[model samples]
Target: MLENLLPPLNDHNLPYPDTIHPIVVHFVIAMVLFAVFCDGVGYFSRNSKLYEVSWWNLFFATISIFVAVMFGQIEAGLALAYPASESTLNLHTILGWSLSGIIAAITAWRYVLRLRDPKTLPIGFIVVGVVLTVLVCFQVYLGDELVWVYGLHTVPVVEALKEGVL
Candidate 1:
């Protein structure tokens, strides 16, 4: 199926060309994409099916994001073994956890509202999804600052340095 064809996470931690990091990055990007799509559907159609799908997407996305965050932490912990930058890593961790919590709350609200009358879905979806999008955007901006500006993740580089592979 088209769904199964999506790239998977790089659990093996291999040094080869391909890894799970890109997959995880895409996964987070997917959340933003889904949010946009769901919001559009809910806003334009106001259809129960669209509302249902949006809530389900948000619920699954929240769980997946938490998993990706754990992977980030593991990568950070490994980086800490050497001369890794602590400030950016700490910021990344804090922002990631905070965003995860917010997403979880939004997911809960979506589902709880979905269980009620279909009319209730739009108001909750608009309010919660809007709030979540703003928060997520802020978190993502912080993440970009951590990586591109500060270079928090030195794990792969450090490993390469140790092995003299580069």
Candidate 2:
């Protein structure tokens, strides 16, 4: 039934069209970075506006990360990843899931803080943001490795997989 309803899979093995994970992941990344930026600037500048912006960004990021992860899980399953890329793919998958939960918890914490005082942010929140940023950077590196170094679903790689070229 699903096979009949779905369109032809692309070279990347996607049903509808081009890879959607990367596109959605970009939004998540931008939101996370910008939220951290707003938190930092809001803290230093004593600007409540930046805090509000940060809150919204984090809130949206929390929602967007789930979307990103959902598509990532789908696309990863279709990637036909070879043995060489398996370890990295596994790690990326773990990190992706972890980030989703972390973002949700952090957003909940931010909501509490916002409700308490929009004008001031705790140093602890800023510290946690730094940790989150590092994790994001590492995840991005792993994702880049998958696409560039491993070429998980690129044309040549997919062709190689089909031809048993590794």
Give the number of the best model, judged by lDDT. Answer: 2
**What global local distance difference test value does model 2 have?**
0.91
Clashing pairs in 1: 10-20
For model 1, the stretches where C-alpha displacement exceeds 4 angstroms are: 1-22, 80-85, 119-124, 152-166
Sequence-dependent TM-score of model 1: 0.68
Q: After superposition, how far is residue 19 of candidate 1 from its true place, in Å?
A: 6.4
Candidate 1 residue 136 C-alpha distance from true site, Å: 1.6
Q: Alpha carbon lDDT of residue 15, candidate 2? A: 81
Q: Estimate each model's TM-score.
A: 0.68, 0.95
The root-mean-square deviation over C-alpha atoms between each candidate and the true structure, in angstroms, is: 8.1, 1.3
Candidate 1 structure quality by residue, lDDT tens digits, 58-124: 7678878877787776665544222344665677678778877877877777667667764545554
**How far in Å is the alpha carbon of 36 misplaced in model 1?**
4.7
Lowest summed lDDT across 10 adjacent residues in model 2 is found at 8-17
**Candidate 1 — what's its lDDT?**
0.62
